[model samples]
Target chain A: MSTRTELHYAFALAALCALDVAAADAPVAPAHPLDAPAALKAAFAERIGHPVNVLSFGFGEHYAQALVQNAAAPDEFDEYEAVPGRPLEPGRPKKAGEVDCRKKIAFAALDLDAGARALAQARAAAAANGYKTPDNVTLGADVFCNDFGWRAILTSDANDDAMLQIVWAPDGTSPKAQELHDGGWRKVDVAKLLAGSAKVAPAAPKAEPKTVAGDGRKRDFRRGIDADLARLEAEVGAPLGFKHIGIDRTQLSVDVFQSANRKRVSTWLVGDDGAIKLWREDDTIPFDCNKPFAAGDFPLAQLPDLVADAPSRIPPMPQAQVKDVAVYRSGLCGRPHVYIKLEDERGYGNVEYDERGRLVSAQIQ
Target chain B: MAKTAVAKILLALGASLMLAGAVAGAEAPGTDYGWPNLTDFLKQLIAKVGAPVKVYKLAMDRDGKVDLWIQDQAHPDLVDSWEYDHGAIEGPIPVKFDHYPSIAALDHHVIELTTIDFPRLPAMLATARTKLGQPDARVVFIELERGDSSGFISVTDTPIWTIALDSPRHDGRVEFDLQGRVLDVDKD
Candidate 1:
């Protein structure tokens, strides 16, 4: 080997040996003692019905300490120190102070098994170099965000060599996070981990509400009264006045004046469900208008055509002169119809046509 | 070639150590020289099972154990998986449909596992290490599909090899293609 390459390999092997020493420092018993803290977390999550933040976990030869915070109530937490195969020591609920929940440990992303194996690789490399691993060496991982929003730090305390320090940032593409990645720090796949676990996935972006306009364009309907009034003009010939009624403001009433007499010619009642009804003055018998016509009660753009063809659809109501014409939806039958008022010096006669302007019925009173 | 020989030597060393039970059940045993051994295992696998019609996924865990999922031609809905650990192979284990995610176009996106250039894997891994740092956990190879904004369209022809780094960088992954070309670097 060249001098530089040998030095590089030698340094790497030495670092690996130190990492191995760190892995061995943890209490040996339950096959994987480092997993004991995560097991406690899993058990606690099972009890709470969801995963919560683990503020800190301290390892010992026989017992591990964990301080966990409630996910719902972040300020509340409990601290427990427990041994393997034994119940957690009882802990009282405590309040969080000066605790940034954002930096809480991500237990799902913490794989101590991998950390130990990496250390073992380091040990093997050291063995190949014929170096004796120091007995007093210690290695550990601190899996929590430090200053950055990304959680988890897989760092070793072996002679300042940050071997295999992995950090998981939500936005892995961030420059700082990427810098950490370039600096020998591995990034955890939090999305994939959460997918395999019971953790709730991140909220999806809100979808835009779909809208249909008379012009076949996605026009915003919430653009104040002028736009709404303009939309209503397509149904009624220039509404003179508009007002919302009913206890819950679920009804809308509009007055239309097409003639130059300055008198209201037609009154239209629209239900919140998009049902429409029309009323005119000097009517003899009240029409059956209980059921309101809702959405799919014919398009508003077709109203002008229906009104214009109403006269030709029926014969004059028994030689009666046409007094006034009004268009409305027969809410009781859920159909749009045009009502033509007629007068023959007696009282008033009426003729009605469907949305297609086909004559349907006639009545005299 | 010298580096490859060194990797082979390390593989032998790891194998002997594993056989001695010194590093058995260790997550990603012999990670320092795991890539060459994995490629060697895959080459042997193709020789044993022949070329697969569709390769669902190939994954190596922290324990240096490899799992390969290939579609069964006779039963199109079932997938046959083979696991390799410590120089021993286990199973053509049949996995039912829906147990794992399915590709949108399985027939069109066939990964010719047999014809893959196994010799280039070590170099590709070295490039990944240089560009994106070492992987602390596992390596995964799967075909990725592009999902449409409407959630109704599927485009599943992209194949990628992901080198997942250890904790904290759990999201960090260095991506490459079958021909050992670097596709993406880190946490993609």
Candidate 2:
């Protein structure tokens, strides 16, 4: 077996052994399923038939109730659950096997300042389990579960009736109930049935390597930047446009504009006092700035007036009360100007007013 | 996404301009202000925000007006206003927080940034790392503010120290008060 596969298998075996010990040590209980997360992940993967990413989950609740509904085909259906953590729900103590399927749950992040601590905890748990979660997030939680980003949910206090009903909106208040037509669910295989179909378990990958800031060394910042730029040019075989640089006793880093239009870019860094070799990756920007600077649509004195109501507000989202528009004090498309963008639930676009506050141009996508 | 100290300082410098405007009785909006005087105020503002990071106020030379916030200062590593403006400056509008798009150089290459209290950075970072119980974590960036640019600043002259830390587990940003107590921690 390859090193990576062997490493993963060894981990799986060790986890299974740990679960066995925990279960055996308890006089009259099943194992304290430390491997429960892995099992659940494998099971979801089997059902999805794709390399399903077990994104994130809630905690605190002792169990998860998986419900299969709207089976388009015998195999094609939807899964939903309700997850609650501590303090949010008066959860009953687990009775060993009682912590099986038929309950949807998650842990609680009781951060004192977590405006949506429970949701944060759930997302964190998912992150820990190797799924994707957004950095900018919001949750509208009431006494029970509110409509999250799902078609349905599972749980007793869940505002939706499908984890019984789905509000299809963040506003899950007074949702139309999905009556348990065929006795909803009583037989959920949960983690046990997927034992055979489960494959390699995936855990959260470690963060990419990066350099730490410096420890107060005395050196020529400009020389270091120049050297690095020369090195980059040598490696890439092109003249790199210098965009930005920061040098101090702690570290030296630089960004380069890689395109003639000036939208393409890359970054280079020398960390650990140049102990680590620098790395580079190129990228591009969308607002094309190939054209020469011209007199824009507005004058300098009325610059603020242009942004006060420029048509750049895109993708406006009133659902989570996320303001859709934002003004920028930066340039775009290789031009120096104040740029703005508008956004909502639909789409977004960009607008650039020249440094003097004249209308340069705008593009929406 | 935090406001730069220089921007705040330039705004504070406006206080003096306001007083001068009042004294000269030239505060009226319609008064057509011309060069030398018009040009001097812009120069002072450029100084207020510090140099090499010029605020491109566009072409308001035709009008007696000004609007600038150090927009074109080449911010190292971070595309200036990347997080704050939601990527409207570089790529498409409303870029994702999770999306740290690879950047290549374009119009700017190196930006000269003026700092205050930079000498104390090492000690402050050490304090923050120890307090955070992240001994292995590294300080990726820092922002140290002592006083505003309008000159003497406040009566107490409180300094703000914000430190950014990157570790294998997660990224953390913290602010320290004058007494070195942690003000807040941002989990990324």
Candidate 1 per-residue lDDT over residues A73-186, each given as its tens digit: 665577655566554434555434334344565445534343333334333333332323311111222334344322222222332333222232322222121113334644
Give candidate 1's iRMS in Å, 1 decimal. Answer: 28.9
TM-score of model 1 relative to the true fold?
A: 0.29
Model 1 DockQ, alpha carbons vs. true complex: 0.01
DockQ of 2: 0.02
Roughly what TM-score does model 2 have, to 2 decimal places?
A: 0.22
Best by TM-score: 1
**Per-residue lDDT for A38-140 in model 2, tens only?**
4433333333342211112322224332323122322222332323221112122222222222222221211112223333433343343333332222222
DockQ of each: 0.01, 0.02
Model 2, B104-165: lDDT tens digits are 22112221223222223345566667666566565555543432321233542444556766
Which consecutive 10 residues in model 1 chain B have the weakest lDDT in total? Answer: B142-151
lDDT of 1 by residue, B113-172 (tens): 534444454456557666754444334432222222111234523566666554322334
TM-score of B chain for each model? Answer: 0.60, 0.31
Interface RMSD of candidate 2, in Å, is 15.3
Lowest lDDT 10-residue stretch of candidate 2 chain A: A86-95
Docking class of 2: incorrect
